[model samples]
Target: MNDTVKRKLNIALRINWFCYVGLLLLFVVRNLLLEGGSIQLWVIQTVPLLLVLPGLIKQRYRSYLWLCFILLLYITTSVVGVMMPTRGWEDGVMVALSLILFFSAMMSSRWHRMQ
Candidate 1:
């Protein structure tokens, strides 16, 4: 890839990382505040994301692809949360972050292979 494509890939990767971390934090905080700090809930929500961490840190295209799939689960749950009568802003934020993460990861992986 040329410099511009490389630059774009880096930006997408950075956005992917940022959104990934944001979703992680959101899950942690949401569990703590709404689930009485339930360890089980935290583990269930975060373990999949954590599983991809090693590959993600290595900037592996396969990891990014897997992340896109993993994020779909989050988006589904967040959409349900949004539809609930007692939903809060966090649900909306979660949906936004997950979507951003999914797209960025997808694009990052595509760009990675272009090199």
Candidate 2:
């Protein structure tokens, strides 16, 4: 990639990383605080994300692909949450953050590979 495009890709990757973290935080808050779930339960629920975090921090395209699949699950969960009566807004936040992460990762992968 050219200098400018590589820079842009880096920016996108950073956004993707931050959004991923944000979504994870949302999950923790929703499950542990809002729903009164136990820490062990929350850790079990979010463990898969931890597997991908290192690769994502290293800006690996493979991790982005894996994250896309994970984000789909999150999207579905958010949609179901939105359908619920009380938790709709929280789910909406998840939906938006997941989408942002999804697009950022997707674009970063594409552009980075074009190098």
Candidate 3:
């Protein structure tokens, strides 16, 4: 509602848009240079995630809840994989990324709300 919140929200939205565009560009490169349907799927999955960015920027409670759910799922998957015999390093990376997103959403929302 305040100027600080507006500024933070704008920044969050800008960052989110940059990421979304980057992802799509990667997918395009993969499709053009390489050749993979999987890359296409990744790009498609990216859209919904990008779509949620606006809500997060607005400091919507539901967006925060969604972020919490995502973090929980990331944690659960990483833990399960670590406990498993055939664990992969990327699973840990997933956990890290999830934490980053979660913290970013919370901090950004808080920063936006403070103003």
Task: Indicate which candidate wins on lDDT.
Answer: 1
Query: What are the per-model C-alpha RMSD values against the true structure?
Result: 1.3, 1.8, 5.5
TM-score of each: 0.94, 0.85, 0.50
For candidate 2, list the clashing residue pairs, or say none.
Answer: none
Model 3, position 17: C-alpha lDDT score: 43
Ranking by lDDT: 1, 2, 3
Candidate 3 backbone overlaps, count: 0
Sliding window of 10 residues with minimal summed lDDT for model 1: 30-39
lDDT of model number 3: 0.58
Using TM-score as the measure, which candidate wins? Answer: 1
> 2 or 3: which has the higher TM-score?
2
Give the TM-score (vs. native) of candidate 3: 0.50
Show model 1 residue runs off by greater than 4 Å. Answer: 33-37
